[model samples]
Target: MPFAQIYMIEGRTEEQKRAVIEKVTAALVEAVGAPKETVRVWIQDVPNTNWGIAGVTAKDLGR
Candidate 1:
């Protein structure tokens, strides 16, 4: 089995997240020869307030 964990700031639409999962699964299947059904992808969305960029929070940085 191949597993991928992705972290990004919150606010992506459902469609965008879906695409990420699908594309990531395909990449893993092609790169590691994992079966499509055995590929696992997890997306962790961090709130802007909780995510930091340089010395500022993502929210403050307008991310």
Candidate 2:
């Protein structure tokens, strides 16, 4: 089994997230020859307040 954890800012639509999941799953399947059913992907959507860049929060950066 192959597991992937993806972290991103928390503002994408459901469709977008679905697309990401599908693409990531496909990548894992192709790259490592993992079975489609055995590939696990977890998307972690972090709030802007909890995400930081260059010593500033994403919220503070208006991201």
Q: Considering every candidate listed, which one attains the maximal lDDT?
A: 2
- Give candidate 1 misplaced runs (Cα > 4 Å): none
TM-score of each: 0.95, 0.96
RMSD of each: 0.6, 0.6
lDDT of 2: 0.97
For candidate 2, write residues 1-63 as lDDT tens digits.
Answer: 999999999999999999999999999999999999999999999999999899999999999
lDDT accuracy of residue 17 in candidate 1: 100
Residues 11-61 of candidate 1: C-alpha lDDT, one tens digit per residue:
999999999999999999889889999999999999999998897999998
Off by over 4 Å in 2: none
Q: Give the TM-score of candidate 1.
A: 0.95
**Candidate 1 local Cα displacement, residue 49, angstroms:** 0.8
Instruction: Report the C-alpha displacement of residue 56, candidate 2, in angstroms.
Output: 0.2
